[model samples]
Structure formats: structure tokens, C-alpha cells
Target chain A: MEKIIGFYPGCSLEGTAREYNESVFSLAKLFNIKLEPVPDWNCCGATAAHNISKKLSLSLPARILSQAETAGMKSLLVPCAACYNRLMVTQHELFENEELKSEVEEIMGMGLNSPIRVLNVIQFIQEYIYPGLQEKLSSPFGKKVACYYGCLLIRPHDVLNFDRTEDPQTMDEAMKMIGAESIDWPFKTECCGAGFSVSRTDLVAKLSGKIIKDACDRGAEAIIVACPMCHSNLDMRRNTIDRLLGYKTEIPVLYITQAIGLACGLSVKQTGIQRHIVRVDWQRLNSCLPEKMIKEEEDIHG
Target chain B: MYYALYLITLLSKYMAKEIYQNNAPHTLNNDLFHEIGISSARCYQCGKCSAGCPMAEDMNYTPNTVMRIIQAEDRQMDLELLSSESIWLCASCEMCISRCPMQIDIPKIMDYLRQKSLQERLQDKAANKSIIPFHQSFLDMIRYTGRSYEVGLVLDFKLRSKKIMQDVDLVPKMLSHGKLPFLPDGIKGKKNIQAIFKRTLRKK
Candidate 1:
């Protein structure tokens, strides 16, 4: 029997991070885990709600959790770090304050009767995939990559409480599991200007430019990330980042699932590698694959 | 002579209180505590928040300065802080709260201030004009479709901010990659989502 877990792909996964969605689902299929989408799920009210109304922020996530509870999911796999953070923080806030919780319940028109575990992509991998990852690996991803945790995944430590806030090692450990070297870099957990990606493109350029520069300076071939926002800021905003840096940097940003998928014998198309705006160099990644897998790739193509 | 000096001192103190009362309606510190249960009084001029802030360079006032201004508890300073662009510029990265010795929850305070700023129609005072419109556009998408629609959000933001063609080049690339879908995937619970928005964010 396959393990079943709730999956919340959030808005970005549908829109700008379609590759993330594909890679996540493909990895789940490979791991024999079934991802159940929360039925009729609404948005988690990302930064917009919290910035304007506290009640809306708590209520939006509360509704999502309520739906998950109704569906009898013990644990929810939120691939987007922003949604994961919002759900976790909302749970914590509701648990701490009965008045606010009831108020949110009234607004949501549902009761969050049971607590459901909200897991980010890193935690999801650590929980379900890491145990059997070694047995399934067909190729060792022999490359040095920077594991960028971004802001939401690690900070507000008391609420999410997944790993070390400043210097997170969970993604690094997961990278190491797949035979990749996680580099020691300063901007691993830095802010990528988050939702400001659209409004303040210049700010995203500056902040994301620093992260890309650091990864490149440390000789990282790719930057591994779990958040859609971080991926977009680093990958989609590459031209802006390059302009800000006064020189072009070619480090491709890969979702952690995509990196793990590659190691687990998934093809480039399977992991949606072609979706990236930065243009991931397949030749560079091909060199990192095991000799057997490389020969198999050539045989299939030839 | 001693009694006269003592009486004058007491009178001056009373007059000062009256003058302060006449000047400002309410202190920002008390309002923040009442609104969000976060107290700026705990912050003791620690610059750690500003030091760790990613956007401090572009902000009109740093996080520490905002906290200090809130602690001042004066009406003018509170209004100034609310209307200041610093509150709007906060990325809510939580770096300050994570590292602050006091654990002041500056992000929550920033949220509360942003709400107050919008309520008082002081958002125009924000120098970084595009931030609020982007947030509004994002919420508008969610309100209608029950999820964020990137193309709609971009169009709405462009219209609101009038800074069209800022990232016009990325749209074609995004469309080619199948990242930007022409139509939004609306949830079945669209009405419920609208209710959530209407109930929680009631119009002033």
C-alpha cells in the first residue's frame, strides 16, 4: 500500500512555478507516495492579507486547515514555503489564542477540530523520501550546490520550528543524501525580496543578485531551493539580477525535488528542467551523473 | 518661599500633561499593544533588527528607529511612524524578531502599522508607491478567482501603479515555458472565499 499525504500546491505552483508542481508530483510518483489535493481549497492569503488585515490572514489559512481536517489528512505537504509558513503560523496563533481562533472559525464558517501537521518540501522529503532514497538512486548528483532556504522556511523559528533559523542544514543534508555537495554560503537563508518580486523588481534584483553572486563565487553549479518565491526570484529574475551585478551569472536554480528526481533516475523532461528561465545547462548536469546513466542516456537518444 | 517653588513645580507638571493631551489623540505603543498584543516598550534601542534587515538600506527609517518612534508614545511621532514608508517597506522576513534580544515581534507590529496606515488613508505618504497597489492587486485576484492569477495581478498592478511595461519582456518567456496560463483555475468555493474576504476585511 502506498503512503497517502495531503498536498497543497499553493497559487505559485499553478502559475509561475509549474515546473515545481510537475517535479513534485513526479517525485511523489517515484517514491510511491500518493498526493491528495485538498478539495475546494482556497488561497492561504499570503503576504497580502497579513499586511492589511490580521483576521483575514488567520482566517484564510484556517479555512485550508479546516478543509484538510475534513478530508481526514494527518499531515499536509505544502510544497510552497510561503503557504507552509502561513498554515503553521496560523495553527500556532489559533492554538495560543482561543478568542482569535473562534473569531477566525466564525469567519471561515468551519471548525478546525483537529490539528494537522504542515510539512514544507524539505520536511516532506526528510519524512517520506530520505529513508528509501539510497536504494532508489540510479545516479549520484556529483555537483556542489548551494541550498537556499530563503526566508519563510526557516525564520519565525518558534512557529515553523523545522531547522536552525540562520544556518539551516536539512536541505543540505538532503542534498548530501543524493551525493551532492552542499556548499557553505552566507546567503543560504537570506531574503529574496519575496512577494515584492512583482512590485519591487529592483529590490528583488538586488537581494537575489547577492544570493546568486555568493553561490557563483563559491563555485556552486546550481542553487537548490524549495520555495516557489525563491526559485522565481533567483531563476526568473536572472536578467534583472545580472543587470544589478553588472555581469552575467549563469547559476541555475533547481527545486530540491528536481535535484532529487535527477538522482533517482528521472529524465530531464520528467523534472521539467526545460521550464527554467535561466536555462539549466544539461551538459554540466550530465557530467555529474554516474557513468552508467550517462551511457544509458546516449544509448536511448542514439 | 519653599512652598511657592513647590506649588510652581506642581503647576508646571499639570500644564505639561494638559498640553500633551491636547496635542496627540493616542500613542502608537498603546494602540499596537491593543491591536496586536505586541509592545514596542520592550525594545530598548537595540539595532540588531536594523542590522539584520534586508531592506533597511532602502527604508526611510530603519526597524530600530520605527520601534523607538513607537516607544516615544507621542501622537505626532506615532502618526509619522504610521505614515512613514518604513512600515510599508518591511518584507516581514522576521529576521529582526528572530534575532532581537527582546523578541519584540516587529513584523506583527509592522503589519498592524500598515493596516492603520491604510485605514487613515496615509498610504499615499509612502514613497515606495508600488507596494500597496501590488498587494491590493494580489488580494483582488484572490477575491475573485479564489487564487492568485499572475497575469491578472500584473495587469491590475500596471493599471494601478501606471508603471506599465516594467517587466513586459518576461511575459512572453513565461508564456513559452507554460508558466503563465491565460485563464485562472478558480476553486469551487469561490463564494466562500469572497465571504472570508468580506467578513474579515470589511470596508471602512
Candidate 2:
């Protein structure tokens, strides 16, 4: 008898990082774990929603959890940090506030299961997905890589409470399972200035430049990101950083899943390497990932 | 380019010594702060908000320090580059707001400072060139269309900003894999979105 957790991957799945969504699903099958999808979901109302109303901000994610509760899901597994934070905070507030639970029910038309649990993708994988996946590791990545968590995933302490939000690398623990090294560094949870990458590109570029510079300064081979928004700012915005800093800093940025997927015999192309602006063309990276990941493109496309 | 030079010149006076005082008549006075729903009086002067702000170390006055100034009801501090970056640098991740003991929505205050700074063009020295235009283009897109059309926003931001050519080598690959969409498709009920945006002036 295997346990199946309810999965709530946010809108990024619909675009940007479809591979992550696919990789998680495929990896679940490999681990003999079931990931049932939460039905009829809406946006988690990330950084944008708080501007509207704090109550509404928390309730948006709470509505999804409420749906999960109605469907009898004791715990919900969320992939995106922004979503994980909101959902987890709602769970925290609901359990803490007796009156608010009934108030939220009247607003959302559903109730959270008492003691409703919300786990980040990394948290869930580290606890449930790591052990079984560890059995299939074909290579070890002792490469010095900075694990970037950035803001909501770890901050405010009360919500999610996974790791030190400022300098978190719990992915280092999970990365170890698939046999990869996670460099311990200070810039892990530093803000990439994600949303502002568009509005205030200059600030984002300078800060992102600093983040990459810190990782490179510490001799990191690459930077691992879990959030698509973070990934976009840190990785895709490389050209902007280069123009601002007047140098080429082509550091590879991969979602943790892609790294694990590569280690577990998934292909580089299969991990969505092409979508990255700063390509990870490191020789050491080449040596750490398994041969299967390298040949994966040929196998799938040929 | 003019704004960037303008901001740098403002920070030029701070070259002798970064004075924490720049006197500019700001709309963020006591009454205005209340109008925006940020109560400076409630802030405990705990530098946590400043400490948590990603751009605080680089800023002249931190979000926490700004709150302290607003709390003590002292409005004489010079907050040029610091306030601008403090507000602009906020990713709006709400870390400061979430952590505040008094539960002040510092991010909103930060947005006000950011908008003011951008409007005044006072502290634009190191504005993320690519990031800002990308943001303006996106806002313009949303302003034109109710909700964002990711494909449209991406295409226009890149094309208009002249950055598409920089990444043109990679666009072929992105388009090949369907990572970049060909059309600008937006949310169905755009009128409702327009109403929302029209009804509420976020920082104005």
C-alpha cells in the first residue's frame, strides 16, 4: 500500500516550467507514490494579492485548501514557494484562530481539516520522495552549488517554517539524496527581485548580479532555484545583468527538480535546459550528471 | 538616461558623507500614511523590516528606519536614494509586512516611495535597466488589456526594449519547444479586470 498526496502546482505549470510539473509527475511514478491533483484550482494570488486585502490574500490560497479538505485531503503538497507560503500561512492562521476558521468558511464556503498540513515540494520530496528516489541514484554531484530559496519560502518564521528563510538550503539535504552537493552560502535566500525584474529591472539586475557574483565568489558551479519566478529573474535576466555590470556572467540556474532529474538518469534537454538564458556548460557539471541524462535527448527525440 | 543621471547627481552630494537627511516635500506625511493604510505609529522601530529588506544594506534609510522616522513623527530626514531603492527594491514578497509585530503593511509604503522616486526621477542611478522597462511594458500591457497576456507582454517588452535581439539566438530554441508562445492571449473577462484597476489606484 502506497501513500498518494494531493498535489497543487500553481499557474507556472501552464507555462514557463512545464518540465517541472512533468518531472514531478514522472518522478512520483518512479517512486511508486501517487500525487492526486487538487481540482478546479485558481491562482494562489502571490505578491500581487496582498496589495488588495490581507484577509483576501490569505483566503485565496485558503480556498484551495478548503477544497482539499472537502475532498478529504489531510495534507496538501504545493510546489511553488509563493503558493506554499500563502497556503501554509492560511493553515497556520486557521488553526490559530477559532473565530477566523468559521469566518473563512462563510467567506470561502468550506472548512480546512483540523490540523491541515501543507508541505513545500522540497519538504515533501525531502521527506517522502527522497528516500525511495535515493535507491535509484546513478551519480553523485559533490559540485559546489548555491541553493537559492529567496523570501517567502523560508521567511516570517511562522508560515511554512521549513528552514532559515534568510540562508536556507534544505534542498542541499534533498540534493544529497540524489547524490549532489549543495554549497552552503549566505546569498541562498537573498531576493532576486523577481516581480520587479520587469518593473525595476535596474535594481533586479544589480541585486541579481550581486547574487551570482556571491555564488561565483564562493566557487559555486551553479545556482539551484525552486521558484520559476526566481529562476526567471536569476537565470533569464542574465543578459540584463551583463549589460548593467558590463561583463558576461553566464551562470547556469536550474530548478532543484531538474538537477535531481538529471542525477536520476533524466536528460539535460528533458530537464528544460534550453529555456535557460545562462547555459550551464560546466565541465565539472558534465562529469557529475549521469550518462543517461546526457543521452536523454537522443533517446527521446531519435 | 536622463533619470539615471538625475538620481546619480542627487546621490553626488552624499559623496562627502552619506547624509541621512534630504529634505523634500513628500506626500507620505502622517495623514497620507493613514490614507494608504500604513500606520507608522504602530511600528516598534524594530529594524527587522529594514534588516529583512533585500536592498536595505545598499539603501540610505531602511524600511524599518523609515518607519521609525515616520513613527517619531520626524519628517526632516533626507531619504533620496534610500527611500527610492528601499521602495523599488522591495520585490513585494511581503516579508517585512508579514514579520512586523504591529502588522504594518510596509510593502505598500515601499510602493509609495518607489512610485514617488520613479515619478520624481530623483534616485534612478542604478535602476535595473532591463527590469524597469520590462515592468513598464507589462504595466502598460495590463493597462491596455485588463489582465496580462504573457506572450504579448514578453514579445512587446523584448521587441520594444531592443532586448529581443540580444536573446534572439535563444528565441528560436524557446519557440521550437513551445516555451515561447506565438500569440498574445489574455484572460477572458478583461472588462472586470479593467474595472478593478480603474476602481483602485494602488499608490496614487
Q: Using DockQ as the measure, which candidate wins?
A: 1
- TM-scores of the candidates are 0.91, 0.71
lDDT scores of the candidates, listed in order: 0.88, 0.66
Task: Assess the local accuracy of residue B20 in candidate 1 as a C-alpha lDDT between 0 and 100.
Answer: 87
Q: Tens digit of lDDT per residue, candidate 2, span A21-71?
A: 766766666677798877755556565554334454556667677667767
**Compared with the true structure, what per-residue lDDT tens digits does model 1 show for residues B27-76?**
77877777777877788886999999999999888999998888777788
lDDT of 2: 0.66
* DockQ list for all candidates: 0.73, 0.14
For model 2, how does the per-residue alpha-carbon lDDT over B121-195 read when each residue is reduced to its tens digit?
555544535545565555555545533445676677777666664445556655665566444445443443344
- Model 1 segments more than 4 A misplaced: A282-302, B1-25, B126-128
Judging by TM-score against the true structure, name the best candidate. Answer: 1
Let me know the TM-score candidate 1 reaches against the reference structure: 0.91
Clash statistics: count for each candidate: 0, 13
Docking category of candidate 1: medium
